[model samples]
Target chain A: MKPEELKYAKSHEWIKLGDEAVVGVSDYAQHEMGDVVFVELPKVGQKAEKEKQCAVVESVKSAFDILSPVSGTITAVNEAVAADPALLNQSPLDEGWLFKIKPENPADAETLLTWEQYQVFIKQA
Target chain B: MAEHELRRTVLNETERKAGGKMVDFHGWELPMEFTGIVKEHEAVRKSAGIFDVSHMGQVFVTGPDAFNLLQHLNANDLKKATPGKGVYSHLINEKGGLVDDIIAFCLSMDRYLVVVNAATADKDFAWIKKHSEHMSVTVENKSDEYSILAVQGPNVPLMMETFAPEALPLPRFGIVEKDIHGRHCFISRTGYTGEDGFEITCPNDIAVQLWNEMLELGKPYNIIPCGLGARDTLRLEAGYLLYGQDVDDDHSTYEANYGWVVCLDKGDFIGRNILAEQKANGVKRKLTGIVLSERGIPRQGCRIFHEGKEVGTFNSATYSPTLKKGIGMGYVTPPLKPGTLVEVEIRGRRVKGEVVRTPFHKGGAFSKVLYTGKDK
Candidate 1:
């Protein structure tokens, strides 16, 4: 089950809103992509548009893009995940957080699906 | 569009119960990975792993003219495949393009068992039958009637000694009919993972029984049930080509870097003339192995550049679990040398790479045995 506090995107990214939004892939996303082997994180100060491809996560089978949930400027990246990609599969919501973005409009996070709605959305998908 | 039903092997339910992630593989519902691709890959490398390869086709050619028919249809010299021995060869069309790569096991002087790729089974059967029209051979497709299980890794020989003792003395590529777990089956000392292992072919009814028995018996050796994901990565690391991916109807044996399987001096075959011509005047594009120097993964259709110019595209590529690097094979023109520097374009960014000798990981069981000149 997804954390009730986080918001979700249709492309499967999850965001925790605050002064700076923390972003990572959903558990469902990580489960669908088996055994993450490598991750390409976005650089600090880079501009990210909402729902745009901002990072790449490569599994043993294929590569997948991580879309930004809300438009902002990249603030930081999780260096731990870069060092060990399997952390994404192990703790996707916590230590596997990919990046932090200072949201252009903090209200944009509210526009995204709530945890319960995200669950229903994925079930329909 | 109409929903197309996928075919399932006899071990489908068993694989699902083992935690396999099912996926559609060429119209067949097979496991993409069981536990995980990397873990399964390592299991086969370090200890032992079992694979459900029942999707591979089996065609039997039996008659007085079995030898002649196979000899005329394939590019390899089948004369060397005496009784109980198998020969790997390419079935080429009249235009010298690959119909499929196959392993013909000489069951006897009058009978042969040809194992082919699952995707090309029907086409290969039709081609073989069409070519055998004038020959005194009975061609039969027994793919649906049988199941194949491959037990591979460094510990296979030791593991086999526990249950199938009769398979211990068999030479590499040797096959024989024996009773395994109270069921009669054909066990061949051959595998695609570059490991010293056996591929057991048994009746469909006995497959589930055999699978469960092997897994139970193999627990002492840390044997895990691997899926196609692991199988593909293992084969890539071993430098074995996938028929439809690395070799297709558009590519010839010589162009695919499989000229070693062709025996031009072995007399007339379907594509001997063209293969001979290409062998005499070298192929224009040769399949070469490329290893990335950076952290990114290389994938199929990735453009390969040499000296700032595009030269080839990756036909088959994967992140090699054993090597922990991106490696791939592709047809490059003007054949790059082993140390030649190249760049692979991944997602519009160029990554440094170099052409290298294949069998990307040389620590496989088969390599150690072959290189040390061991009699076993």
Candidate 2:
């Protein structure tokens, strides 16, 4: 997923908006995490702030926090992510999307990233 | 320090490709593992596996006072160590907690070698050097001079025969004196995986050749490369304690279930009197093993419960490939014994378990097995 289609945070979170804004971690973050096992998703209707930690992802050997990419009220979550966390390893961009939210301000994500900008950001990382 | 990617001398470039999932450990990047933990773990149990253990630190302590240096630094007695033999001991600070657990080997009458945990190597070396200045001893960090590989399993030695059969004649815990494939090599019959295996060390230049040669030689046997992923699970299955996670400088050997190595009978040494007094008075805490009776795996730092209250926390945990159950090691209030019922909190639920002996080796150490049964 291009960082431009979604917003990104320096903390490694990325968000994609379609129907509802979907949030997940970046490829850079996943690579650094090494492996993906368990993911702790925030409950439905939880309010989240930009760059705030909203969920947790666990690998076989490690556990890490997932920061929210855009401030919003979570409306629905991908239950499949929790049932089979390996989705992150398989298709991190499509079926692997984490949770959904009805953002208070969708435009607020404008400052997050552009496709080219995220590439530069990742290189800098 | 996190500039581009962290790299350290603990592991080499070839080791990075061996499924190390490189992590920055004390300024060095080393593989945590290559394949998934469960599969890699079972490989060591049922067959043979290789571990890139280059991250471990090797330090040389020499001079006339080398014996005196070891006596003052380690909690265990080193005066009885004969050449070519090694003994496990605790490197400790004044407070009696362990700085690191190390293997001290007597290389020669005046030369000694100490193998320490990679993360604590600098601290152990610095501490050894800082204290040795007044004792007429000199410490040199030899970590950069070598790369290590631990070929472990039931058939490691048998498999090594194809590559270097001459090493087979060396006794258990024996160290070879020559080079392998033209590289300076030392092979010792010891391993962290609780197997009858060798920790092979050689000059960095020949590491790749030796690894390739071992692979070629081991091809007939299905020996696969293992990473730290399997390494941890194997050690956990064997009930070995990791330095930073399972123990620290704040915990003494008396409390960690290693009193036999303390050797209080051998006159005064660092922490000897304290260990003796602790032994007499009974240490306040003890490290014990646990086998969970629930489905969930108990992991590190998980709170351990006894009855209703929180009593301890698991230091390390894993699902044993042999026992096929969740097992762990942790420190608990003293008087804890085998069959003592306890619980490990996993995802907020207290799973039932019982304290067991240090290690319950299923079918003996994984490497010592020789299949007399016909290949099925």
- B356, model 1: CA deviation in Å? 0.8
lDDT of 1 by residue, B1-376 (tens): 9869999999999999999999999999999998889899999999999999999999999999999999999999999899999999999898899999999999999999999999999999999999889789999999999999999987777777767777777777888888766776899888888777889999899999989988988899999999999999999898899999999888899998887899999999998999999999998899999999998899999999999999999999989888889999999987898999999999999999999988888645455343222355
Off by over 4 Å in 1: B181-183, B363-365, B368-376
Recovery fraction of native interface contacts for candidate 1: 0.75
TM-score of chain B of 1: 0.96
lDDT of each: 0.91, 0.75
Candidate 2 segments whose C-alpha is farther than 4 A from its true place: A1-59, A63-125, B1-5, B9-12, B16-20, B134-136, B360-376
Chain B, candidate 2: TM? 0.91
Model 1 Cα lDDT, one tens digit per residue, A1-125: 24788989999999998889899999999998999999999999999999889999999999999999999999999999998999999999998999999999876776799899999999998
* Predicted complex 2: CAPRI docking category: incorrect
Worst 10 residues of 2 chain B by lDDT: B367-376
- Candidate 1 interface RMSD (Å): 0.6
